[model samples]
Target: MYRSNVLVCGGTGCTSSNSELIIQRLKEEIAAKGLEQEVNVIRTGCFGLCALGPIMIVYPEGAFYSMVKPDDVPEIVEEHLLKGRIVKRLLYQETVVENSNSVKSLNHTPFYEKQHRVALRNCGVINPEDIDEYIAVDGYQALGKVLTEMTPQDVIDVITKSGLRGRGGAGFPTGRKWLFAAQNQADQKYVCCNADEGDPGAFMDRSILEGDPHAVLEAMAIAGYAIGASQGYIYVRAEYPIAVKRLQIAIDQAREYGLLGKHIFDTDFNFDIELRLGAGAFVCGEETALMTSIEGKRGEPRPRPPFPALKGLFGKPTILNNVETYANVAQIILKGADWFASMGTEKSKGTKVFALGGKIKHTGLVEVPMGTTLREIVEEIGGGVPDGHTFKAAQTGGPSGGCIPASQMDVPIDYDNLIAIGSMMGSGGLIVMDDTTCMVDIAKFFLEFTVDESCGKCTPCRVGTRRLLEILNKITSGNGTLEDIDRLEELCNYLKENSLCALGQTAPNPVLSTLHYFRDEYIAHVTEKRCPAGACKALTNYYILEDKCKGCTLCARNCPVGAISGTVKKPHVIDTSKCIKCGACMEKCKFNAIVKR
Candidate 1:
C-alpha cells in the first residue's frame, strides 16, 4: 500500500489551467526523488472550488493546495513528499489556522462547511475513469438491490416517497413521471437522459457526468426497469468532450462487468444504454426537443397535450431526466426514501446542486438543502461577493428564470418560493450580481440569448422575443421613451401567454423580474436618458474628475483615441466627443481620476 496519495483535479476548469502538466511533473519529481512506491498520483474530478484551480489535495493528511503551478512540483516533491515537510505557502489560505500555523481539513473551510453534497457525493472523491474505484464506493449497490430484492413498483414508490423533483428547469416530480411511463402500455418504451446543459452560467450536470458517469448509467438502468424499457439513450452536447469520453468508458466498463447488458445482476430484467450527441442547441434542453434530436430529427419542442410519459421517442412512452436528476437515483434507492426525504424542506426534499458564478468569491459548485436561504448561499457559502462589492441581485435559472433582489435575500430558495418571488429554481445556476451591475442590461443580455436561441417553430417566441430585444436595445442606446417601456411590459406578457414551448413561455421572465425589482434603473434609461450603473455605453460618457487627476499624462498616454489632453502635474480634461467609452484610461489610471456618468 502507498504511504501517501496525491489527488490532482482533472476537471475542465483545472485541466484548462494545465493541471495535467502539473500531474506529469508531479510524477516525474516523485520518481526522481525515489518516492514513487510510497506516493500515488491520481487524477480526480472537480473539488467544487474552481476559482483556485488547478487544485491539489494530499490525502491522509488532507492537505489542500490551490493554484498549483508546474514549476512548484519539484519544491513540493522534495520538501513535502521526500523530506516530510509541509509546503505552507502553497496551502489554501482558508485551510491554514491563523496563529497555530496548522493546516485544517478542506471540509472545515467556509466554502464547504454549509454544503450537503448528494448528487455531487462522488465528485472530487474518486477517479471517474476507473470503474473498480466506483464499485469500491458501493457504486452499483442500488441497482443490485433493486434487481435482487425490489420490484419495479417498489422502486417507483421509494422514489415517489423521497420528495425528489427534476433538477432540470421545470421542477416536475420525478417519481410521478416514472409512474406515468410505467403505467403506459407500450412494446418499446425508452428511457433518455438529458445532458445537453445549455444554460450559460451552468455546469452542474456536466460536472456530475465528468465526475460520476456510472451513477447516471446505474440510475438509468434502474429507471429502465421501472419503466419496463430495455433501451436507454443519453442526449448530451458534443461540447463536453471529457464528460462524453468518460460516459462511453463507463458504459463499456459496466457492460464488461455484466451491469448493463442482458439479465443484469442475474435477473430476468434486461436493459442497455446508448449515446446521442447534440450540436449544442440550447432549446434541445426541452424534453420533447431532446427526444426529437435523439430520433434524428430537427431538435424542436412539440405540443404537450401528451407529454413524453404518454408518447415520446419513436412514438412510444418515455421518461427523460437531466444528469443531475439521475445522479440522485442510486443514492435514494440504496439509502431508502426517508433518508433522502429527511434532508430538505416539506415540499422540496434533498440537496440541490448549483453552479455558483458571477461576481462572487468561491465561485463553483454548491449542493445545499432545498430550504436554505439565498443569504446563506451568497454570504456564508459563497464567501460573499468579492472585492468588497455590495450584493445587488442574483440571476437564477438562466434565461428561463428571473432575478431575486437583495431585499428578498432572506427568502427560502425552493421551487415554490422562487416562483412566488418572481424567480424560479431553474437548472440550478445561481449568478450573483454586484452593485455595479445594471439590472436593465442584465435583462437585455438574457433576452438577446433567448432571441438567438428561439427554435422559430412558434411565432410568439420567434417574433415576440425579437421585439422585446429591440425595445431593450433602444432603451440602452438612449433612444427610448416611456411608451417603449410600457410596450416592453405588454409584449413580455404576450410572449409568456402565447409561446409554443417553455423556451418561449419563460423567455419574458428576466424582463418581468427586472421590471418588478429594478424598474427605477429601467425608467432612468428611458425617462432620464441615463444608465444608473454607468454600464450602457450609449447612455454614458467619460469625464476626468478635475480634482482627483494628478495629470501624470497616463490617461492621455493610454487613451487609444487621445481623448484626454493635459500637461504633466496638472489636471486633465476629456474630449467627450472623441472618447470611445472603452474604460481603458480608467483601468490604467493609478489615481481614481476618470469617471463614467
Candidate 2:
C-alpha cells in the first residue's frame, strides 16, 4: 500500500480546467523526488465544489486543495506527501478552521453543511472507472440484495414507502411508475435512464454519472429486476463525453465481474443495459422524445395517457427515470426506505440535488433535504450572491420553471411548495441571480431557449412560442406598448393549454413567473422605455461621469466606433448615436468615469 494517495478531480469541469496536467505534474514531481512508490496519484470524479477546480485532496490527512495549478503540484508533493506537512496555502478556505490549526471535515464546510448526499454519496469518494473501488464502497450490494432476497413486489413496496419522486421535473412518484410497469403483462419490457440533461444551468445528472457511474448501472439493474425487464437503455446526451466514457468503463467492469449479462449472481433473472446517444436536443429530455430517439426516429414527444409504463420503447412496456432519480435507487435498497424517507418534507421525501450556478459564490452541485429553505441554499450554502451583491431572485428549473424572488427566499424547497409558489422543482437547476440582473431579460433569455428548442410537432409550441419571443424581443428593443403585455399573457396561456408536450406546455413558466413577480419591470420597459436594471442594451446608454473622469483620453482612444471626442486633460463627450454600448471604455478606463444608465 502507498503511504499517501493524492486524489485529483477528473470530472468534465476539472478536466476542462486542466486537472489532467495537475495529475501529470503531481506524478512527475513525486518521481523526481524519488517518492513514487510512497505517493499514489489517482484521478477521480467531480467533488461537487466545481468553482474551486482543479481540486486536489490529500488522503490520510484529507486536506482539500482548491483551484490547484500545475506549478503548485511540486510543492504539494514535496511538502504534503514527502515531508508529511500539509500545504496550508493551497487548502480550501472552508477546510481551514479560523483561529485554529485543526481543520474541519469537508462535510462540515458551509458549502456542504446543509447537504445530505444520498445520490452523491460515493461521487467524490470513489474512482468511477474501477469496479473494485465501487464494490469497496458497497456499490453493487443493493442490486445483489434485490436479486437474491427481495421479490419484485417487495422491491416496489420499498420504493413506494421511500416516497422518492422523479427528479426529472414532473415529480411523478417513482414507485407508482415502477408498479405500473410491473403490473403490465408484456412479452417484452424495458427500463430506460434519461441521462439527456438539457437544462440551461443544470449538470446534476452529468456530475452523478461522472462521479458514480456504477450507482446508475446498479440502479438500472435493480429497476430492471423490479419491473420484470431484461433490457435497459441509458439515453444520454452526446455532449457528456466524459460521463459516457466512464459509464462504458463501469459497464465493462461489471460484466467482466459477472454482475451483468446472463445468470447474474448465478440467478435466472438476466438483465442487460445499452447506451443510446442523443444528438443534444433539449426536447429529447422528455420521456417520450427520449424513447422515440432511442428507436432511431425523429426526437419528439408522443401523446401521453398510454404512458411509457403501458406502451413505450417500440410499443412495449417501459419505465423511464432520469439519472438523478436512478442514482438514489441502490442506496434506498441498502439503507432502507425509512432512512431515505426521514430526510425530506412530508409530501416530498428524500433529498434533492441541485446544480447550483449563476452569480453564486459556490457555483457547483449541491444535494440538500427537500424541505431546505431557499435562503439557506442561497445565503449559507451558495455563500450568498457573489461580490457582496444582494440576492434578488433565483431561477429554478431552467426554461420550464420560474424565478423565486427575494420575498419568497424562505419558502421550503419541495415539489408542492415550489409548485404552490408558481415554480416547479424542475430537474433541480438553481441559478442564483443578484440585484444586477433584470427580471424581464432573465425571462426573455429562458423564452429564447424554449423557442429555439421547440420540436414544432404542434402549432401551439412552434408558432406560439415564436410569438412569445416576438413580444419579449419587442419589449427589450424599446418598441413595446401596454397592449403587447396583455398579448404576451394571452399567448402564454394558449401555449400552456394547447402544446403537444411538456416542453411547450411549460415553456411559458419563465415568462408567466416573471410577470407575476416583477411586472413593474415589464411596465418600465413598455411605459418608461427603460430597463430598470439597465440590462436591456436598446434602452441603456453609457454616460461619462464628469466628476470621475481623469481626462486621460482613455475612453476616446478605446472607443471602437470613435464615439467619444475630447482633448487630453478634459472631460470626454460621447456621441450617443455613434455609441454601440460595448462597455469597452469602462473596461479601459483608469478612472471610473463611464457608467451605463
Candidate 3:
C-alpha cells in the first residue's frame, strides 16, 4: 500500500482550472522520483470549496493544497512526497480557524459549515466510477433493507415521515406522489427520474449524478419496490455526457451485483432501469413533456390535474422526481426521518443546494440550511461581492422565479419564504448581483430565455412572452413609451393567468419582479431614455474623463467607428453623432478615463 495519496479534484470546475494536468504531473513526478510505491495519485469529484481548485489534498497529513499549478508539482513531490514535509505555501488560506489549532477540513470551512449534505452525502468523498467504493459506504444497503425487511406501504411510511419533497421546482411531497402511483390499480406502473436540469446556471443535480451515481440507482430501486413498478426510466438531457457515462457504468455495476433486474436482493422484487436521452428542450423539464418524449413522441407539455403521480408515462400509474430529490431517498431511509427533519427551517425541513453564481467572489456549489439569511451567504460565506461592490439584488429559481431586492436581504431563505416574496425555490439557482447590475436588463435577459424555451403549447405563453420580450427590448433600446410599460404589465398578468403549464405561467416573473423592485431604473429607461447602469446601449453614451485621459490613442484607435478624435497628450472628444455606444474606447483606455452615462 502507498504511504501517501494525493487526491486532485476531477469535477468540471477544477478540471477547467487544470486539475487533470496536476494529477498527470504528480504521477509523473512521483514516478520520476522513484516514489510510486510510496506515493499514490487520485482524481476525485468536487470538494465543495470549489474556489480553491485546482485542489490537491495529501493524505496521512491531510495537507490541503489550494490553487495548485503544474509547475508547483516538482516542489510538492520533492518536499512533501520525498522528505515528508508539509508544503505550507500550497495550503488553503482558511486552513486554520480563527481560534482553533485543528486545521479546518473542507467540512469545517464556513462555506460548508451550515450545510447538512443528506442528498449530496457521497459527493466529493468517493470516486463515482468505483463500484467497490460505493459498496463500502453501504451503497445498496438501503435497497437491501427495503426489499428484505419492508413492504411497499412501509417504504411509503418512511419517506412520508422523512418530509421529503420534489427538489425540481415544484415542491410536491415525494411520498404522497409515490402513494398515488401505488394506490392506482393498473396492470403496468412506471417510475421516472427527471434528470433534465434545464435551469440556466444550475448544476446541482448534474454534480450529484456525476459524483454519486449509485445513490440515485439505489433510490430508484427503492421507489420501484414502493410503487410496484418493474420498469424505470431516467430522462436526462444529452448535454450531460459525463453524468450519462457514469450513470451507465453504475447501472451495469448494479445489475452485475443483483441490485437491479429480476428478484433484486433475492426477494421477489423485480425492477430495472433505462436511460432516455432528451434532445435538449428546456420545456421538457416539465414532467408531462419529459414522459411524452420518453415514449418516442414529440416533446411538449400536457395540462395537469391528473398529475404525473396518477397519470404519467403512457397513461399508466407513474411517479416522477428530479435527480436531486431521488438522491435524498436512500439516505433518508437509512438515516431515519427525524434526522432529516431536524436540519432545515420549520416550513422547509432539509438542506438546500444552490449553484452559487453571478457577481459573488466564491462561485460554486453551496448547500446551506433552509433558513440561512441571504446576508450570511453573500457576505460571510460567499466572501462578499467581488471588489467591495455593494449588494443590489439576487435572482433565485432561474427564469421562472423573481428577484429578491436588497431590502429583503435579511429574510430567511426557504421554499415558502421565497415564494412569500414572489420568488420560489426552483431547482436552486441563486445569482447574486451588485450595484453595477441593471434590474431591467436582468429581467429582460430571463424573459428572453423563457421566450425561446416556451413549448408553444398555448397562445398566452408563446405569443405573450414574445410580446413581453419586445416591450423589454424596446425599453432598453430607448424606444418604449409609458403606454408600452403599462401594456407589458398587462401581458405579464395575462400569461400568468392563462398559460397551460408552469413553464409558460411563470415565464413573466423576471419581468414582474424587476418592475416591482427597480421601477426607478425602468422609469429612467422609459421617461428619460437613459440606462442608469449603462447596460442598455441605446440609452447610454460613452464619455472620456478629461482629468484621467492619457490620450495614448488607445481609445481612438480601438474605436470601431472613428468617433473619438484627439491628439497625443490631449483629451479626446467623442463625436456622439458618429458614436455607436460600443464601449470600445472604455475598454481600450488604460487610464480609467472612459465613463458611460
Candidate 4:
C-alpha cells in the first residue's frame, strides 16, 4: 500500500486556476525524492469550496491545503511526504484550531458542517475517470438490486413513498412522473437526464456529471428498467466540456462492465444510453424544449397539456429528470424511502444542492436539507456577505426566479416556501447580494439575460421580454416616468399569464420581486433621476469629497476622460459633465475622496 496519497482538485474551477500544474509538480517532486513508490497523486472533481481552490488534500493526515500552487509542491513533498511534517502555513485556516498544533477534521469546518451530501457523496472522494474507484464506492449496486430483485411497480412505489420531489425548478414528484410514463402504453418509452444547467451561477449539475458520472448513468439505467425504456439520452450543454468528457468516459466504462448495454447484470432487460450535446440554450432547460432539441430541431418549447411524460421526444412517452434529480435516485432506491424521507421537511424530502455565488464570502457549491433556512446557508455556511457589507437580497433560480429580500433571510428554502415568496426553487442557484447592489439594476441584469436567451419560438417570451427589457433600460438611463413602473407591472403579469412555457411565464419574476420589495429604489430612479445604489451609470454622478481629499493629484492623473482637475497638494474637483461615471477617479483615490450618487 502507498504510504501517502495526495488528491488534487481537477474540477473546472481549479483547472482554470492551474491545479493541473500543481499535480504535475507534485508528481515530479515525489519522483525526485525517490518516494514515488510510497506516494500517489489522484485527480478528483470539485471540493465545493471553490473560493479556496486549487485545493489539495493529503490523506491519512487529511491536511486540507487551499490555494495550492506549483511552487509549493516541492516543500509539501519534501517536508510533508518525506519528513512527515505538516505545512501549517498552506493549510486552510479553518482546519487549524486556535493555539492548537493538531488540525480539525475538514468536515467540522463551518462551510461543510451544516451540509448534507447525498447527490455529491462521491464527488471529491473518488477519481471520476477510473471505473474501479466508482465501483468500489458501491456505484452500480443500486441498478443491480433493482434489476435482480425488484419489479417495475416496486421501484416506482419506493420512490413515491420517499416523498422526493424534483430538484429541477418545479418540484414535481419524481415517482409520479415516472409512473405516468410507465402507465402509458408505449412500446419504446425513453428516459432522459437534463444536464443543461444554464443558470448564471449554477454548477450543481456540471459538478455531479464531472465527479460522479457513473451515478447518473446508473440512475438512468434504473429509470429505464422502471419505465420500460430501451434507451436513454442525456441532454447536456456543450459549454460543460469537463462534464461531457467525463460523462462519455463513464458511459464507455459502464458498457464495458456490462452495467449499461444489452442485458445488464446478465438479465434479459436490454437498455442503453446516448448523449445529445446542446448549444447552451437557456430555454432548453425546460422539458419540451430539451426534448425537441434532442430530436435534431431548434431548442424551443412547445405548448403543454402534452408534458414530456405523456408525449415527448418524437411524440413518445418519455421521462426526463435533471442531473441533480438523477443523482438522488439511486441513493433513494438503495437506502429505502424512509431513510430518504426522514431528513427533509414534510412535503419536500431529501437534500437540495445549490451553487452559492455573488457577493457571499465563501462562494461555492452547497447541499442542505430542504427546510434549512437562508440565514444558515448565507451566514453560517456561506461565511455571510464579505467586507462588512450588509446583506441586501439573494437571487434564487436565476432569471426564472425572484430575489429574496433581507427581511426574508430566516425563511426556510424549499420549493413551496420559495414559491410563496415570489420565487421558485429553480434548479438550486442561490446568488447572494450585498447592500451595494442596486435592486433595479439587478432586475435589469436578469431581464437582459432572459432577453438574450429567449428562443423566439413563442410570442410572450420573444416579444414581451424584449419590451420589458426596453422599459428597464429606459428607467436605468434616467428617462423613465412613474407611469413606466405601472406599465412594467402590467406587462409582467400579462407575460406570466399568456406565456406558452415556463421560461416566459417566470421571466418577469426578478422584476416583480424587486418592485414588490425595493419599490423605493425604482421610485427614486423615476422621480429624482438618481439611482439609489448608484449602479445605473446614467443616474449617477461622481464627486470628490473636499475634506477627504489629501491634495493628491492621483485621481486627476488616472481619470481616463480628464474629468478631474487638481494641484499636487490640493483637493481635486470632478467635471461631472465630462465624467463618464467610469469610477476610474474613485478607484485611484487612496484617501477615499471620490464618491458617487
Candidate 5:
C-alpha cells in the first residue's frame, strides 16, 4: 500500500557498508515527515551487482542507487521519497538518462547485461526471512506437487531427464545419488545439505542460502520425500551468521505452515530437518567427512565402496547435496525435465552459479549457461580485466582448482572442457587474473592453502601437499633449480595417485596447471634467476628507470626503507639490498620510473 518502497541491501556485503543504518535513517526521516504510511523501507538480500552496495532501489520508478552512505539516506528520503524526485547525482552512470524517465533500472546495467540468473532466480527478488514471500513465488509448490502426485521413481525420472549434477566440486548425477538412497534397504534413511562453503573465491552457495532460503528448504523436503527419508540435516559453518539466521527462520516458517514435520500436506509423509554446525574445516566438504561431522565425530574422508546414499550419516542411507545443488531441485521438478536440460552444454546441464571475484570489473554472484565461453564471461560480462591489463589467467574452484592461461581463453566453460585443459569447474568460483599476476606465486598461494587445510587423514594430502609447498616456497625464495620441475612433477603425480579423498586427489592441481600453462615463467625462475612477473620478492629486483624518471622524488618519499637515493630533478639509484618489493616506488612514480626486472 506504500507509495514508495526504499529497498536497502541486507546482504553481508552491504550490511558491512552500513546499509542497515541507511534503512534506519530513511525510516526516521519518513516518520518525522509523517510520510511513514506512504513510504516504507525494507531490507532485502544481495542484489547480485555487489560492487554498487550498499545498494538502494527506489520502487515505482525503480531508481537504482549504488554505494549510498548512512548520511546520504536523509537526502534520498527527502528528495526522492518525499518530494517524488530522483537523485540525479547518485544514479548509476550506465542506467542514467537526461530527464523524464528514471535510469533504465538494474537490468540495463552494463555488468548484468549478459548474466542469466536461472539458479539465482528468486535470490535477489524475494525476502529470504519471510516464508510467505518464498511461497508466493511457488516455492513449496514443487514439494507439494511432488508429494501429492509424483512417486519416488517419477521424481528420479524427472531429475535424471533434467541432467542436473552435483554443484559441490565433484559433478555426480543428483538423481543417481537419490536413487542409490531410495534403492537401499536401511530401516531408516536421512538427507543432508552441505552448506559449508570453504573455497576462498566461492560465495554462490552462500548467496543462494542467504537470499532464497526457502528454495533450499523446499528442495530438501522434496529430496527427503523422493528418497524415502524422514529426517534431514544441514551441515553449515557457524562463521556464516547471516546465512545461518535465514536458514533457521525458513525452517521455523516451514514447520509453521505444515511444509515440514509429520504428515506434510496430509500425505502420510512425516519428515523434519535439523542443523549441525561445522567448525569450518575445509575437509568436511567431502561426503564422508561431512557425514562424520554431522555425527559429532572428527570430520575426515573415508574410502568409498558404499557411498553416502547406500550407507551414510550414522549408518543410515543418506543422500547429500550442497546448497547450490538443492537450490535447483524445486525448479527441476516444477519446470519439467527438458526445460532445465535445454540450458547449459551436453555434459553439464542447467546453469551454474559462479562467485565472480578477484581482479574482475564485476565481483559478485553470476549464473550462466554451461557452454558460455570464458572469453565472453571475462571480457563481455566481467568488463575485462580492471585497469586495462591484459588477461593472464583465471583461477576457478578454490585452493583445489587450477589457474587457466589466456591461450585457453576461448575454451567452453563446462565440466569436461575445464578438466581436459588442466582446470575443473569446482563449485563455481571464477577468479580473474591479469598480466600483473605471477603464476608461480599464484600456484604457491593455492598450494600453501591446501597444505594448511589438509586434514592429515591421508599421507598424500598431509605429507605430499606439504612437500609441494616446501618446493614452491623454495622456488619463490630464489633457491630453485631446473631439476625442481621434474621433482615437483614427480611429487604431484605421487600425491594424485595415492590420495585418500578428493581434497588430496586435487591438491596438486594448481601446481600442475601453472606449470603446464606458464612453464616459461617457471624456467625463468630457475635458469634466468628471476621471477618473470616480478612477483616473487626474492627473485625480483626493483630499479628506477633513469630515462623515464623525472626526478619527482615521490618514490624516495614513499619508500618505507628509503631504498631510492635521489635529489630533485636528478635521476635516482635504488639500493637493492634495502628494497622490500612492496611496489610503493612504482605506485608513487607518476612517470613510470620505478621498474621491476
Candidate 6:
C-alpha cells in the first residue's frame, strides 16, 4: 500500500550502467526521509530502451528517467518523491510533451509505439525473483489450466492452432514439434530449453530470462505435461549471469509453492526442471548440440534424421525450444490459439521479438507483430540511422542470415518473406547499417565469426569457411581478381549444399547476400582495389583537403609515423609509404579536412 513505487531496471544493460547502485541509493534516500512505508522501490527487468539505461520509472505519476546516475538520487527523492514534483530535466525526452510541462505515456513514444509485446509482456512489469509478483500477473495460470482441464492432445492442438514458430533461428512450427514428441511413447521423454543465445548483437532470449524467468519455467512445465515428460533441463550459456541466477531463483520458488515439483495441483502428473551451464560454445545453440552439451559431452551438432523430438537427450524422445519460444507458450495456452493467430501474417503467425541493434538510434529489445515492415522498425521505431547518416543495409539472423539492402526495407518481416529476400528470421537479431558501413566488410566480419566458431565437426564449416575467409582477406587487402569473386560464389554454394549441419549449410548467407545486393562494392574492391566505404585499410588512403586544411600542423603532429609533412598555414601532404592507415590524423583534424579514398 505504497503511494509511490519506483521501478529501477535491473536487467543486464542497466546493471552494467549501475542501476543496482541507483536502487540502493533510492532505498537509502527513502529511509532517510522516513517515507519507507509510503514509498516502495522495486528492481525489475529491461524496459527495452537500452540506449537510455540505467532507466528509472516512478509509478502513479509514471515519470520515466533515463541514464540515471547515483548522484542524481537526492534530487529525485526530495523533489519528486517527497514533494510530488516531476523531474523534467531527467525525464526521457520522447515522453516529455513539447512546449508543455505535461508528459506522455512511455507506450506512446516512437520507440515503443509500434511494439506489441507478447513474449515480453511480463518483462519490466514485475520483479522476476519474486514468485508472488509473478503469480499476481496470472503467471502459472496456463500450467494450472493445462494440468487441471485440457488433455495433452488438446494442449498440442491449441499451440498448433496458434501458428507459433520456434524463435530459435529455424522458424519451425511449435505445435508440430510438440505433436511429434507426444506421439512417441517412451519410458523417458525430455523437455529442453535453448537459452544459449549466440547470435551477434542479439539479447532477446537473455532479456526474457532476466525479466520473466517464470514465464519460461511455467511454459516448460506445460510443455512437459503436453509431451509427457517429468524432467526438463535449460541449457543456458554461462555468460548470462543475471538470467541464470534469476532462473534458479524462479525454479526454487516454484517448487516451494508446489507449482513445479511432484503432483502439481494434486494431479497424477509430475514434472521438474534443472539448469545446465554451457561454456559459451556458439555451435551449441543448435538443438542437437545443446542437448549433447547437457549430456556432459563436447558441444557439437548431430545429423538430423531422427530430430530431437523423435530421438534426443540421451537417446530419448525430446522436444527442444529456445527461451523466447517457450516464453510464448503459456500466453498461447491462456489467451487461446486464435488470439495468438489473429496478430501475425497467415504463414508467420504471432508476434516476434527482435534484439534491435547496430547503427540505429534506439538500440534495444523490440517485439512487433510478424510481417511488420523493416522500414517501420528502422525508420519509425528505431529512429533510423543516427547522426544524419543515410540508411545503407540491415543484417539479420547473425552469421547465419543475409543482408537486406535498402531496396528491400519495405518487405514485410516474416519467416517466408525474409527467406524470399535471401535472409531468414534467424533468432530475430536485426542489426541496422548506415551509409558509412562497408557491405563487403560486413560479410567478411560475419564470415570470420563463423570460421572462428565452427565446431570443426565437418569440413564445409571448418575448412571451407576458412578458404572463404582467405578470399575475403585477399579482396579486402587490395589483391583480388574477378576470378576470385567467382571462386567465392562457387565455394559458398558448395558449403550450402554439402555442409553437415545448419551451421555449415547457412554459413555462406552473409557472403552470398552481399555479393547479390552489393556486388558493386565487391567489384570495386577487386577491379579498382578500392573499398568504396573507405573501411579496408589496404584499399583506402587518407588525404588532407587543400581547401579545408588550414595547415594547423595538427595532422602532422598526430600522425604516429610522421606520414603527414606540412607547416603551419600550409596544405599537408601524406607520405603513403610511411602511413599506417590508423586514421589518427583524420580523427585529430578539427578542420574536417581529411578524407579517406
| lDDT by candidate, in order shown | 0.93, 0.91, 0.86, 0.92, 0.87, 0.93
RMSD in Å for model 2 = 1.2
lDDT of 3 by residue, 461-563 (tens): 8899989989999999999888988898899999999999899889888888888888889899989999988788788888888998877989888888899
Q: How well does candidate 3 match the true structure in TM-score terms? A: 0.96
TM-score of candidate 2 versus the correct structure, residues matched by position:
0.98
Better of 1 and 4 by lDDT: 1
TM-scores vs. true structure, each candidate:
0.99, 0.98, 0.96, 0.99, 0.98, 0.99
Clashing pairs in 4: 551-570
**Could you give candidate 6's per-residue lDDT for residues 1-597 as a string of tens digits?**
999999999999999988999999999999999999999999999999999999999998889999999999999999999998888999999898767656899889999988999899988889999999999999899999999999999999999999999999999999999999999999999999999999999999999999999999999999999999999999999999999999999999999999989999899999999999999888999888888899999999999888888899999999999999999999899989999999999899989999999999989999999999999999999999989999999999999999999999999999999999999999989999998899989999998999989999998889999999999999999898999999999999999999988889999999999999999999999999899999999999988899999989988887888889978899999988899999999899998999999
True lDDT of residue 399, candidate 4: 89
Root-mean-square deviation of candidate 5? 1.3
Clashes of each: 0, 0, 0, 1, 0, 0
What are the per-residue Cα lDDT tens digits for candidate 2 across 228-296? 999999999999999999989988988898888999998998988899999999999999999999999
Local lDDT at 569 for model 1: 95
> On residues 388-416, what C-alpha lDDT tens digit does candidate 1 reach at each position?
78999999999999999999999999999
The C-alpha RMSD of each candidate to the native structure, in angstroms, is 0.9, 1.2, 2.1, 1.0, 1.3, 0.9
- Candidate 3 regions exceeding 4 Å error are 96-103
Model 6 TM-score relative to the real fold = 0.99
